[model samples]
Target: MNIEDLRDKDLQPQLDELIGSLTRMWATMLDCHRQQRAIIKLVSRSYNLKISFQSESQRQAALLLSVELRNLCSNFQNWMVAQVHETSEEEEEFQETCC
Candidate 1:
């Protein structure tokens, strides 16, 4: 599809779908981030004493916590990308059906 050949009216449905998808994604992401913060706080509190004590157990817990948080961040990123791709595919399908 040539960008120059596309009309705004013809693109409205896809645009609307994309906007709706984005709004939903944003809300979901916000909730997920909030939950992530809570989890991090819980982990931090559990390891807080360990941090000051500087024991092998504390080091292990800290390492594991960091890895878990990293994985969470990676997974969230992948999910967001997937949502975008899914929206695009849906838009394509919508266009096919309507036209």
Candidate 2:
């Protein structure tokens, strides 16, 4: 596709819809990340409490799960940053070519 294709009015609505969907998805992800972090904090605080876990294995499992969740959150944040950077670069290129 050429610059004209990128500037086409027919694609504008689809692009707008995609941006809206992405914005909503980002908001949902942020909410979920906040909840996950809260859970991690709660689990970490109660890590030593015998009442929190029935057995050693269960405690270990909880610790592992929390670690994995933290990693997931970190990975997601990195991915988002990368995506933003990539989009910015693409926009710049598009403008340079089209304008």
Candidate 3:
């Protein structure tokens, strides 16, 4: 129900597992993006035409979506690193206080 419950229940391992899963998922997303780009490039080269959004607004939207995805990934990485540091600090503090 609270911080004490989380600590007492020893949920760190589960949290760690979830983080690992998410990390894998993120990597897959990035791989998919790369594959999509490659496919698009291949198609465009094969056809000798630009393959892209049909309208200016659509192109802008796609650009924004890409920027957002990049920001999301950057923020997620930063958060994950901070979480690892926070967990280690908490463990150290708990050890100091309890033993």
Ranking by lDDT: 2, 1, 3
- lDDT of each candidate versus the true structure: 0.72, 0.73, 0.69
Ranking by TM-score: 2, 1, 3
State the displacement of the C-alpha of residue 4, model 1, in Å, after optimal TM-score superposition.
35
Per-model TM against the reference: 0.49, 0.53, 0.47
RMSD of 2: 5.5
> Per-residue lDDT for 1-99 in model 2, tens only?
787877676687787788678767766866776676687668667756655778999989988987897787679668767766776786688679757
Candidate scoring better on lDDT of 1 and 3: 1
Q: Point to the candidate with the largest lDDT.
A: 2
* Candidate 3 or 1, higher TM-score: 1
**Which ranges of candidate 2 are over 4 A from the true structure?**
1-51
Candidate 3 residue runs with Cα over 4 Å from true position:
1-51
Over 1-99, each residue of candidate 3 has an lDDT whose tens digit, in order, gives 999888667787777677678667766866776676576557446643455778999989977876786676567657656766776686688679756
Looking at candidate 1, the ten consecutive residues that score lowest on lDDT are 44-53
Looking at model 3, which ten-residue stretch has the lowest summed lDDT?
40-49
- Best-matching candidate per TM-score: 2
